[model samples]
Structures are given as C-alpha cells and as structure tokens.
Target: MSLPTKTRQWILASHPTGLPTYGTRTDTFALETHDLPALSANQILVQTLYLSNDPAQRGWISPPSQIDPKRLYVPPVQLGHAMRARGLGRVLASQNGNFAAGDLVQATLNWVEYAVLDAGDPAAGVRKASELPGGLSVTHYLGALGGTGLTAWYGLVEVVGCRSGERVVVSGAAGATGSMVVQIAKGVVGASYVVGIAGSEEKCRWVESLGADKCLNYKSATFEADLKEACGDGVDVYFDNVGGQILDHMLANMKQHGRIAACGAITSYNGEAVLPMKNYFDVVSMRLQIKGFIVLDFMAKAAETVGKLVGAVQEGKIRVGEENETVVQTAFEEIPGTWLRLFEGGNQGKLVTKL
Candidate 1:
C-alpha cells in the first residue's frame, strides 16, 4: 500500500583497471542509497526483482574492444550512476499509458531495488513479465526466454543458417548465451555434429549433457589437438561467443564456405593485451562469412524467437538449465560477487540471483 522513499543502488565508484572484484575492490562497484524522484509525464517506476548479470557488464568499465569496439553495443554508464540491467520487475507506479501499477515487466532497470523507465526509447524497453513464455524461474528473463535466447536464435538460425547435417562448433559454450547457442544448433537447428569449447572439465560435461557430440576444455594442455580432432570434417558453422584466440583456432580449421556468428567477445573484455591471430586471412581462403551481431539488432523478432524457445523447452526438445537442472542461484545481495563467478568459470548454467 505504501512505497519506500529511498532505494539502494550499485553505482560506478571507480573505473576498473582490469576485472572488477565485488565487496572488496575499490574500482568495482559501490552501493549507494538515493531518494526516489517524482516521475515525468512519460516515465514509469519499477520495483526490480531478478537482475541479470552478464559479461557485457565487463565492457562497461573495460576499454573498448581493440579489434572492433562497436560490436559490444554497450551504452555508456557514467561514474556514480546506477548500474543498468534487464530486470524482471513489477511496475509500482506509472505516468505512461504503456504500463500500469502491478504489471509484471522486464526493463532496462537498474541493479537498484527500484528504477524509472521511459518505455518509448527503443533501448529502454519494458516488456510484461507474464508475456515471456517459458521458465523454471523468473530468471528466464535473464536467459533462454530473454535476450540470451534472442541472440542465439537469430545468430544460429539466421546469421549462420545452420543446416541439419552441418558440423557446428560453439566457443564459450558454457556461458548463458553460449550454452543456448549449442542447444539451439543441435536440438532446434538440427545440426549433426556439435562441439562445445569451454574452460573446464565440468563445463565440458555440461555441454555434453546438452547433446553436444563432444566438448573441449580450452585451458587443457592438448586443447588445440582436441579441437582439431573434434572437427572430423572441419567446422561448418562456428558460433563464436568468446572471440580472440578461440575464434582464430576455429577460423584456422573451418570448412570451405563455413559461416560464423560473431557474438560477444568476452576474451578481450578485460582491457588487457590482445593476442594476435595470423590465421584471420583464412576468411579469404576458406570463403568464410563472419558476421558480428548484437542481440538488440534482432529485437523485432523477440516475441517469435522466445515463443519458439519456450515451446521447445516445454516439449522437452531443448535443454536450457531447466530440462537438465543446471541453474545456479544465489541471494540478491550477492549480485556483485556472483558476477565474478562467470569470469572464473565458477558458475554452472544460467547464474542468477533472487530479489
């Protein structure tokens, strides 16, 4: 019946020199309390519930990608400003006709408990939570039924155009988006041989559990040899999620006319030295088509894409942490620390926290 006057938020305290540490580091994030402001004519107030912590947040503080920074499509968040995320929340107040109080919605709300959204901005979109179709949890807004699935659907199906019998390889295959790509490639797109590349044996097993023909740990001593052996007929479509070295390896071993969906490049999001790849010209020799895309580019297809994924999940056709039980959950207060787990390969499937 009554709304709080103050809200807690995580703001940019200082720029991170490298990987930001939660709860301890100075340059990571700082939680600050702010008084709620009155809504404008076209704004709505939201009470954030589940927040999605993604690798893209690394690009927020880290420098632009040295290869081609624009693909990240990261909007700028100035210091002392609250961190923004796509959150499954409820509208507590509204000044716009688009949303009403008590409507469950997903928006570019802040990591804070509450935030204001301008539904008209294409980027600052707010979708009704009840509208998203599939789920074992509300965290689906952060994974398969949200931007993650949208990215995988458009990239694998449209960008790579994977065929039924094609040999597909997915790098960064353990992340939220990467994991979805692997499943969609096999279960939905009908790829014949699917290989996943991640950092650890556990991640590899999770990939295998998702019906991947094989999974390779990129950090292994024989990683290069493993990848080479996995691609018996060479990679037909490579869903590149972690770029840089992994991409170079895939490029060097691709089949002729192979397609690549250039998704996120978390490898270079650390603002560190970038490794050089001499094999990029393989694009010319192999006649490869490497296209970089941001999921936001395919927003128009969100409903249809999410609907398909939801149906697949419900029918037991796709595995997205629900069918196989791989979700990792934590408390709302641990949001900052929980994000660090992704970079370290410490998280299992979709790492999310309850509000």
Candidate 2:
C-alpha cells in the first residue's frame, strides 16, 4: 500500500456559545486539505476508520471565557487546529517499535483522514484493538467493549457497588453507556428490578428491550408521576447520565442510603448554565451517596473490567448492538455534521462516524 501525501481535516473555526452548528453559514468548523509530512522517529501514521462523537466534545470546544480554569478536563481544541476526537484507525506506517502497519488501534485521531502520533505520548492513550473471543466487532471497542461499556461497568460495579435485588434506575437509558448500564444492572448484578428514563417513547421502548423492567418517557407531561409510580418503593441505585431536572427527580425518588453515579450530563452540555439541584438536600436527609466518575479514572482496572464484560457478552447475559448503537457512514466532508447530530438527539445509543 502506498501512503498518501495529503490528508483532509476539519479545523476548528470558532467556538460556539451554546449548541454547535456545522456545515452551515454559522459552522464552527472549516474543512481544509493539508500536506501529510513524513513520520519522525518514534512516530506512527494512522488512517482513521471510525470516529467517536461524544457529549464531551461540547466542553472541548467551549469558549475559554465560558469555562472555569479549575474545572477543565482535557484542554480545548485550539482555533485553526484539527478538531479533537477519538477514533479507531489502522496503522498505515510506523517508525516506532511498538507499532507496525496493519495494527488496529484506538486513540485520539482527531477529525482528520490521517494523523501522525508520537507513540510515547501519554495523552494519546493509544491501545491496540483486537477481536475478542466472543466475536465482538472492532467497532465494539469504541462502544460496548470500550469506554461505553467500561463507563457503565466501572460506575455500577466500582462506584455504586450494585448488588442483587437492588432497584437500579438509569438516566439517558437508551444511550450507549446508559443502555449498557441498564443491561449490566439486570443481567450482571441481578438487580430485582431496573427502570430507564429516556426522551421519547421510541427510545424508552428500546431501553425496555435491553432487559429493563420498565422504561419511562421523560418527554411526557406526566413524566414525574410516571417515574414516581415506577419506583414504587425507592431507587437503590441511580446511574445518572443527564444531570439536570432528571437528577432532581431521581434525588426525590431515592431509597435510604441509595447510591448515585454521576456520569456525563448531556442535558447540561449544551446549556449555558447547569442549574442547582432542587432536591439536593435529599442527599443529607436520605443519607444518599453521590459519586462522580470518569472512565479514565479506572485505567488500572481496564483489563479486569473488559474481561468481565466480555464474559457476560459471550454468555448472552449482557447484550450489545441491537439498538445499542447508531453508526453513520459518510464521506469525510460530512464528519462535522455527523458530530453535531449528537446534541440534536439524532442518534440512539453510541454515535460513531465511519470515515
């Protein structure tokens, strides 16, 4: 195979005030072609195959003025630079001893057709992706078998310590990580009952199919009543994915000493302000435990977590891929729009762009 001398990229044109728009007059990105330079020693050049579009991208592209210096995770994408994104790619060529051509890897490949990465950069967090014994696809590494599954597993197992007969409720229930959490709660932990909250009836139905005892459509006028009724007794574990009004509702419905896993807050990602929780006092009154976690926090346990999830998957206990993902295959030029779809509720489960 011959290496291409040029690569196309979507450069960050400007930061957005709220929800991001792309490929339009007010687009936040600009497409450009650039020369692909030769790899330096200890560098590997990768051809991107798939890109992971995540809610975190909103925080990544937030204007510096809108972000508090103390709260930032990864640094924001600089203006005129390739838009930051994680991707599954193949090693097209390598000058590094740790990698070789034809190796599949997962890393921060950005929004470019090709990228040259330093093999030793810890920030890159490159990992070799291999087919699992259970016959999971490479794309699963971006989803159920990767961060999505890991996030669900780590939060439920490590953070919440979910146990048998506990009642589990997951917000963003039909989404990638939320869906995984729903299945793991019922299948892996043997939760007596599991409930999911999603934005629409269609999504709620999908969540139910994932083994939830019931799924609530949060968009309905009677959402609060429905949620309260479904809990009946109380929620023992809450896997919070959207942390706004839904969190407030969950707070009100928690059992004594219930555990809440603070995952991503998709609802607040596009908003200018994250409102104060109205029922936050319940934490003290009910002796509840609220814990915030990022999947990166458990890198030391990645191998162990994956091993458990893989076994559950192989046994058909924890399901993946039937409504657990939405993948878009398009030309590289459409990549920007595809990412923007995340905020628009344009996808179900894990959103991936096949480049």
Candidate 3:
C-alpha cells in the first residue's frame, strides 16, 4: 500500500507559564506534500483517528526550573518538536508482516493526522490492530480499554492493593482514570464505600453515577468537611489523581496501614505553590504507605490487565460511561490553542483531537 504523501501535525511552539496555554504552548504544522520515508522491514504507516489530551501531557512539558526537585515528572516538550501524545489510528501502509493496511492500531502517534513508524518503535507497538469487538466504539479503545483503563487497574489493584470492604477515595473523580478507579474499586472489589472528589457538582454527580458511594465537589468551600463526612470509615486506599491538598486531606484521614497510589498530580501541575501537607505525622503513626507509580512501570502487564478490563466491559459487569463532549478544531491550524485549554481546566473527560 502507498503511504500518504502529506500529513498535518501539531507542534510545540513555546514553553508554558504556570498551566499550559494552548496557543502559547502549541502550534500546528501542515505538510501539504511531504514525502513519506520508505518503510523499513518492520514498519507501518498509520492514519490517526483519535488523539488523547491528558493532564499528564501538561506536566510533560513543564519547565524544569519551575518543577519541584523532589517530584519532577516528565521532561518539558522541546520547542519545534512534534507534541507527544497517545493516539488510536488505522494502518494505511505496512512493511511489517505482523500488521497490514486497514488494521486498526494504537500507538504514541502524537497529535498528527499521519505517522510512519517501525513496529519495534517503543511507542508504536500494536496491541490490537484488527477484529474490533462488536458494539464497542473504537474511541473506547483509547479510553476505557486503553491507557486510561489500564492506569486505573494497575494503580488500584497493583499499587494501592485495594481490597473488599475497604473504603477507597479517588481524587479527580470525574476524569477518565479517576472515574474508572471508582467503578473498578466498587464493582470488582466490592469496597464498603467508594468516594470521589471532582471539580464541580455535576462532575461529583457523574462520579456517583459510576457507583461511587459518595462524591464530593472539591471546588466547594466545605470540601474538607464534605470529604470527612463522606468517608464515615477512614479511607483504606486513596487513588490520588490530583495530589496537593486532596492528598493532604486524605493523609490526615487515612486508616491504619492505608495505601495511597500517587498517580498524576494534576492539582499541582500549574506551578502554583503547593502547601506542605501538615499530616506527615499520620503517615508514621498510622503506618500508612504512600507510593508513587508511573503506568509505564507496568507496561509488561498491560495485556493481562487490558484483557480483564475488556472482559468486564464485554460482560456488562462495568459501565464505560461516555462523556461525549468533543472540542473540534478547524483544520490543523488550531491545535496549539486547543492544547492549552487543558491547563485552564477547560476540558472534561478525554480530550481527543480529530484531525
């Protein structure tokens, strides 16, 4: 099959200030007739369909000088670089025996309309390229059945070791990973209470709809009180997506031997001064364990984890609720402005760039 002669991509324009600003942090590059390099023996060309915009993508490009030394995450995006992102795409051309044209695949295809990569590219492995299940939208493969779902499964099951009858709390409850954590903890483990903290009342309600026993709006003035009242039993596990204050609060209320999974810290991503947690004493007194985890660490187990999650979805044991709001950009020119919308708290659920 012939590779497409041109591709459109979003490129990094400048470093961000505080949280990411779309136009400032990103720019779009258009290649009307760029030639595709000849594919190597184990390579394929992909046509991107859905690109994920995650909060972690924000931290990936945060300036080193601004980031805290103790908790530095991914490095900043280099200027003039094609922005890094996870995308689901269809194989348009293939030189590898493992994949072929028309095969649907997922890869780190970035925010672009097309990409060519070797099957062995660390970011371009093909997990499932064909035989998409009936009744499942391809987009779910990028969300519930993809990275978001895997992250939740790994963090809750592996890192936090959530158990039946324990109380679990998730920060960033309305977001993708947070929402999945609530459902998996409650549905799979039968947690006594699954509580979620989201940014708004609507998001709190959405979290509750996902089987969370209680959901609190962190944006409220009485958030701490609400959180305390919601978790009648002290939290046994905290799946922290937004760290900083929510973590500090959870730390204060953690039960003896409680486990905390430190996922992405969206709360502290904007470079605002994070207040020190006054509850370090609790960690020692209660013998609580707080461990940081990167989903990349569990890539080896992704297949096993994804199989279970896909089965759950297929069996109707868990619901993959769609937050179908899409922020469409005109052509490839608007990506930079679109990307920045994330830092301002302007997006909900998964942000996918439709190229």
Candidate 4:
C-alpha cells in the first residue's frame, strides 16, 4: 500500500470568541497541508472515516482564560494544533502490536483525514469499533452504542436513579442523549409520565414519538403555562440537557427530594456565561438533588453499559441512528458547520459527518 507523504488538517488558528465559523478568512480554524511524519515504534496510522459533532467541542476551543479552572478536562486545543474531535477511523498501517491494517477504531482523530496515534496514549481513547456487537450500523457506535448513549444511561440510571411509575421530565428531549433518556425513562424504565421540552413543535412531536407523554415547545409564548400544565404533580426526576431558563422551570416544578441529572449545558456552550438559577431557593425548599456528570466518569463500566444499550436497541425498546440521527455526508471542510448546527437547533438528533 502506498501512503501519502502529506496530509490536510484543520488547525486551531485562533481562540474563538463565540460559536466558531469557518470560511476563507477565519481564524477559528485554518486548513493547511502538512508533511506526515514517520511513525515511531508502537504508533499506528489511521484514516478518518466519521466524526462526531458534540456541544463539548465549543468548550474545547474557548480562550484559555475564559474556561473555568475547575472544569478543565484536558488542556484546550492549543493554537496552531489540529482541532480536537472524536472520530471513527480505520487503521491504515501500524508499527503497534495491538492494532494492524484495516482494524476499525474509535478515538480522538481530530479534524484531519489521517492521524498517527501512539498505542499507549490513554488520552487518545483508542478502541476497536469492529468488536462491538453485530447487527448494528457502524454509525451507531457514535450514537446509541457510543458515548452519547452511555451518558444518558449513566445519568438516568446511576445519578438520578429513576424508577417505575415516576414522573420524569427531559429538557432538550429531541437531542442525541436526551432522546435516549426519553426512551429509557418511559419505554425501558416504565416511567408513568414523561414530559419533554424541545425547541419547536416538530421536535416536540418527535419527542412524543420517542415515548414522551407530552412534549412542550419552549419557544412558545405560553411555554411557562404549558410546563405547569405538563407537570400536574411535581416531577420526580429531571434529565436536564439545557441549563438556562428551562432549568429554572424544572427547578420550580420539582417534587420534594426530586433528583436531577445535569448532563450538558448547551445554553452556555457558545461563549456565554451559564445562567444563574433564579429559583435556586426551590432547591433548598424542596430539597432537590442535582448532580452533574460526564461520560468519562463511567469508563470502568463502559462495556457493561454498552451491552445493555445494545440489548434495548435490538429488542426495539430503543431507537438509534435510523430514527434519531442526522448525518452529513460531506467533506472534512464542513465539519465546523455541522457542529454549529447543534447550537442553532438545525439538527434533529445526533449529528455526524461521514468523511
């Protein structure tokens, strides 16, 4: 096999002040052709196949001074470096013992078509995608059977400890992780009433199809009243994905000792300060328990969790990419725009780019 001596990459040209925009003259990201370096011992070369566009990408590219000191997962993508991203790829060649040519892997492939990764680097999160259970499309590894699905499972099952016949509410209910929460809360866990909050009526309908009893459009003028009506009794569990006014509403409507799983805050992902909980007193008064978690926190149980998720999907208790995903089959240059769609509410569910 002949390998190219050079590779095209999307480098972080400058820190983004807000949602990143890519164009002919943008500093957020700049495409450059660079010479590929020879792989050292225990290094593997991979050809990127698909990329995941997540809300977390925004936080990963913010100005270093702006990011919260406590929330630093890893150092922000440094200037002039390839923009960090999660992707699925195929091993093109390898000097590593664990991997070989043609092995499908999931890792932090960044915004490049070709990547050279060290086999021993745990930060790369290298795993064999081909080893996942059969009968599922390759994209499901990035959606239902991947980190997205695992986050939903961990938040709902472990953090919130949701139970049968409970009243559950999910914000961003039509999104990737949120949609899965709806399925598990209602269909799998047997929640008696599941209310979903989405951006539009179309999304609301889709959320209902995913087993929500009622899906409210937060953009509506009567959204507050609608939320009050949706929560006839106080909510027992809340799966919160957006943390702004909607969170305040959920806080106000929570039952005494209600549990909340703070999964992601898309409302503030794009260079905005997280909105303060005006109804914070509700937390004290009602004794509401809210815990925030990231998917990495549950790495030890990844395989077990993924097994359950696959079981649910196989039994048709949960729907995956075909019903709840939007794929962009475009070139690498369009990746930033695909990521931008999350903040803009331009996508229905998990957004992935097939390169």
Candidate 5:
C-alpha cells in the first residue's frame, strides 16, 4: 500500500518591510502530492506535527548581501523558496535502516506538511524525537528542550560562564529564551542575584515567578533607575537578548571583569534607523568580555545539554513555560503580518504555526 500525497506550503514572495506586512511579500504554494518517491539509502519521509516560528527565521529571509554584517547567521531564503523551519514530526516512510516508519523525529523541514529528508545530509541533522519526561510537554522540545532552551543554556553556561554567587542580568526576560536563562542562572548556578527586564508588568511578574530575584518593566519611565537599584551589587554576567538601549544601561552597571553574552537584538530588528552605542567605552574601562554567538555553533553539545535540562525539569529544580498562538486556516495569509507582531512586542512566548 502507498500513501497519498498533496501538500500546501508557505513561500517567500518578496522582501519584507521594516516589519513583515500582510499582502506585501508572502504567498502560499500548493504542491502536487505525488507518490512517496523511493528514498535513497539514507533518506526518510516525515509528516510535520508542529512548525516552529522563531525570530531567526525572520533574519533568514533578509537578502544575504543586505543584512547587517553582524547579524548574518544563516543563508538567506531565496525568493519563491520554501520557508525554512524546524519541526517535530513522525516518520511515515524510510529508506535508512536506522529510522523506521512511525519513528518520531525532529528536523529542519520547510514550512509544509510533509518532508523528504536525507539522514546523511549535513543540514538535516535528524534526531529521534525526544520523549517528554514527567511534567514536560512535547512542545517543549521545540522551545525549552530544543533550540530556544539550548540558546539560553549555551549563552549562560558557555558564553557568559555564569558562576555561583554571581549577580546576573537578563534582557527580554519574559521570552522563551530569556525565561530559561533566568531559571538556569538562578536555579542551576544558584546566582547570588538575578534581575530580569521585560516589556510589561505582567511579564515582569512572570519573570519573578521563574526565580528572578528582581524584575523590571523596560517600558516603565523609571526602568533604568529600577534596573540599577536591582543590581546594586553589580552585574557579573549580562545575558542580553534585546540589545540597543537596554544593553547601554546594563553596560553602565557592569562590575570590572564582567562578562556579557550578546544574544539576539530584537530591539533593533524593526527599526528604520540604527541606534548607536555611545557608551562602548564601558567595555574598555570595565575590561568586559563580550561575546556573540548563534545556537547552531553549539549543536555539537545539544544532546548532552538536553539531558541535563531534562534532569533539571524532572527533579523540580527548574520550571519551564511556553506561550503559543495558533494560525487559523485563513490566517495563513497573515503570516507576514503575524511575524511582525514579534518585533512589536506582541508575543509572550514561543510562536508557532500549526498546519
């Protein structure tokens, strides 16, 4: 018996404005469903169950030559190309003896319902779908247990090298990656003090619930003073997700020899004008060690990191949360607009599109 094939996909139609807009540059591609082609010796076919929507995906669509030199992380998505995404799926057919049909897997598939992948393909890096441990959700594999989780872990543990009894500050504290950074710094490293900055009072409270010793709303009039007061002991490790002004303020408060992990700069993602840092002299005076990295650079340790995180979650040592929104059938056309919502501070957690 052969399985039927037909699929709908999202494709890039044109470059986006400062923010993605509806009816501007996104289109749906209806692909003819054909019989599952015989896979090569190392190929597998998967049916996507969940599609991940990440900030980095936005950067991927920007013209390669036009993106800021510092922000180039992955190859640009060519116009008319299938939008790239990471997804959780179950194998429906396999040519590789290592993976059998019905095996749950995760891979970087296009934003479509089904994908044909080659296990030996360097880009795919297919792995068995992680089993959800007690009190953990499968979706977490795409968020806390997956890429976002790894981003937080590597930035703190590897880049920032957070130490016990150190004072730490994290920007974008209410976000999926930032939330995990707070918990990992406080619960895992047992930091002496942990401060979080977010965009809303409700998000500030949410950050506090995750063990941040202090939480401040970046949108508040007194945000800078409040942040300074919260970290009076001095910041030893600054995990920055939103750069620009928040980074400038935090740099002013860093103690000598402090380390900063420069993560995503969502603050500048939507801006038409670049914000200049007038206080870079702080890096020189404080002898700060500032490092920037992408999560893909740490893929070699993903399995080990996932194991540790799973252990932490199972022992009640660390808490995890997720914010998700469903893209309605008609709303498929609204993806570009929906993507822009992230830059406007409209999303609370990991955003995903369900097919």
Candidate 6:
C-alpha cells in the first residue's frame, strides 16, 4: 500500500498557563497537516492505532520555564512539536530488518497519524502483538496488559513488596493503573482487605467491581470517615496515584512500617499548589516506607509482567476494560479535552484516541 500523502498532527502551540486547555488553540496543542516524508534506512513508518492520554503527558509537555527545574520528570515537548505520547501502531512500511509491514508495535509515537521511528529510541524494539487468547483486544498491549499494568505491578509487587493478608488501600482506584493495582492486590497478593478511593459513587462502584473489598468517594462529605472505617484495623500497603491531601490521610492511617507506593501525582500535576500534609510526622511515628518509582525502571521484566497481567485477565481474575470502560477511545482531534478529563477525575480507565 502506498503511504498517505499527508499526516494530521497536533502541534504544541504553546505551553499552558496552568493545565492544558481545550478551547482556543493557543493554550496547548494545535492540529496541523504535513506531507509524508521519506523513510530512511533503519527506520519504520507506523500509522498510529491507539494513543494513550496520561497525566505524565501533561508534565512532559508543561513549559520547563514555568515548572520547577528539579521537578520535571520527562523532557518537555518543544513548542511547535508534536505532542509527546506513547501509543500502539501498525508498521505500514519498514526499512529495518527487525520489523516489517503489518507488524504491531508500541512506541513513543507522537500525537500524529504517521511517522518514521528509528530503532532504539525511548524504548526500542517493536513488539509483535500476537498469541493472545481469542477475543482479547490488542489495545491491552497499551493498557492493562501493557505499560500501564506493568507500572501497577512493578509498584505494588516490586516497589512496595505487597504480600498476602496485608490490608491495602489504593487511591485513584477508578483509574487505569490504580484499578489494576486493586485487582493485583486482591488476586495475586490475596490481601485481607482492599479499599479504593475514587471521586464519584459510580466510579467507586466500578472500583469495587474490579475486586476492591470496599470503595470510597473522596468527594463525599464523609470521605475521611469512610476511608477510616474501610481500613478497619490499619492499612498495610497504600498504592497512591493521587498525591495531595489524600496522601496525608494515608500517611496518618497507615500501620507501623506500612509501605506507600507513590506512583502518579494527579493532584499536583498542573503546577497547582500542593495541599499541606499535617500528618507527615506520621512517617516517623509509623515507620512508613514511602517509595516513588517509574515503570520503565522495571523494563528488564516488562514482557514477563505483561504476560502475567494478561493471564490474570484471561483467568477472569482481573476485571479490566480494554475496549470498554477500562479504556476510553475517541477521535485524535479530541485529545486535548480527553487528556483534560484525567485531571478532572471522571475519565474512564485509560484514555486513548483512535487515529
């Protein structure tokens, strides 16, 4: 098949004043079209199939000048550059021996329809997505059975060392990674009690359905009391996705020597002022282990972890939505608003856009 004449791309118009805004193209990404360029040797041209919209994307594209230099996680997308993102795509053409036409791959595909990817960049090696149980979506390679699930696995199993009979609490339980953590805690770790904190009653129900023994709505008036009641005895492991006042509460309620896995900080992402944690002193009193980790740190075992997550899904243990609620898919043009939903706290599971 001949390559497309032009590719639609979302160029970063400018850095956001705070969080990225959807209205008015100046605040964040602006859509642009470009003619397809030549595919040089050792490069593979891919058509983006699914694009992941993550909170980290916000931090990665935030203006470095406005953000604290020390706090920057990933490299910021340069102005007028394609918005940075990870995605699953199909190799339409290739000049590399390792990859070929019709191969499915996951890579640092920009927010564009098509691009040429050089070997060994931002995670090399295009994985051949195959050999899954019948009826499973390949999109899982980007969500539950991919980096998202691996992040949850690495943080809970490797970083926090979750064990059987431990009482676990998960913040942002309704999210893509957090929901996976709840399931892993319930099935793999056999936790005595698994509680999740979300923002809405409906989302709380979804969290519970995903295997949490209990779920609490942080927006409710009795959220703190409900969380305390759900913990009952004490929380042995706290898998935190949102880092703000909830973290302070988790710190205070944690059992002595309990482990806290600091994964994503959706609470403080847009340069918003961080909430005061009056209970940080509990870190000393409770001997808490607050550890922060990046999923890529465990890439050595990425394939292995992804296979295990897939098995759990196949075994009917981990209830994740790859094409349904677990992942929300939309047109590529809606990415700005779709990403903004992550901070708004109502987005279903992982946010992905179909190109």
* Stretches > 4 Å off in candidate 4: 24-26, 131-134, 273-276
| Winner by lDDT between candidate 5 and candidate 1 | 1
Tell me which of candidates 2 and 3 scores higher on TM-score.
2
Tens-place lDDT digits, model 3, residues 181-280:
9889988878888988888888778778889988898889999998888876588999988888888899888889999999988767777888988888
TM-score of 6: 0.93
Q: Per-residue lDDT tens digits of candidate 5, residues 85-191?
A: 88778898889888999898888877666788997787996888756876455777788889998999999998888999999999988787898999999999889
lDDT of 6: 0.82
Candidates sorted by lDDT, best first: 2, 4, 6, 1, 5, 3
Q: How far out, in Å, is residue 37 in model 2?
A: 2.2
Rate residue 128 of model 5 by lDDT: 86
Provide backbone clash counts, one per model. Answer: 0, 0, 3, 0, 1, 0
Encode model 4's per-residue lDDT on 186-254: one tens digit a residue: 878889999999999999999998889999999999999999989977999999998888999899999
Question: What is the TM-score of candidate 5?
Answer: 0.89
TM-score of each: 0.90, 0.95, 0.89, 0.95, 0.89, 0.93
Off by over 4 Å in 3: 1-3, 22-35, 67-76, 131-134, 324-330
Q: Give me candidate 4's TM-score against the actual structure.
A: 0.95
- Candidate 5 achieves a global lDDT of 0.78
Q: In lDDT terms, which candidate is top? A: 2
- How does residue 228 of candidate 6 score in lDDT? 79
lDDT string for model 2 (1-355, tens) is 6898899998888888777766643578888889998999989999999999888788888877877645876678888899988899999999999999999999999999999998789789787888766555678788888889999999998899999999999998888899999999999989999999988899988889889999999989999999999998798999999898899999999999999999988887776587778998999999999999988899898888888998898898988753667889979989978988887788888999997
Which scores greater on lDDT, model 5 or model 6? 6
Q: Give candidate 2's whole-model lDDT.
A: 0.88
The models' CA-based lDDT, in order, is: 0.79, 0.88, 0.76, 0.87, 0.78, 0.82
Q: What are the per-residue Cα lDDT tens digits for candidate 6 across 1-355?
A: 6678689888888787687765346667788888887888888889888877788787777666767647765567788888888888989998989889989888888888898888555454466677467577777677777877898999999999999999999998888888889999998878988999988999889888788889999999998888778877689999999999999888878999999999988888888898788999999998999999998788888878777887887787787555334455678778677667777875667766666
Ten contiguous residues minimizing lDDT sum, candidate 3: 24-33
Better of 1 and 2 by TM-score: 2
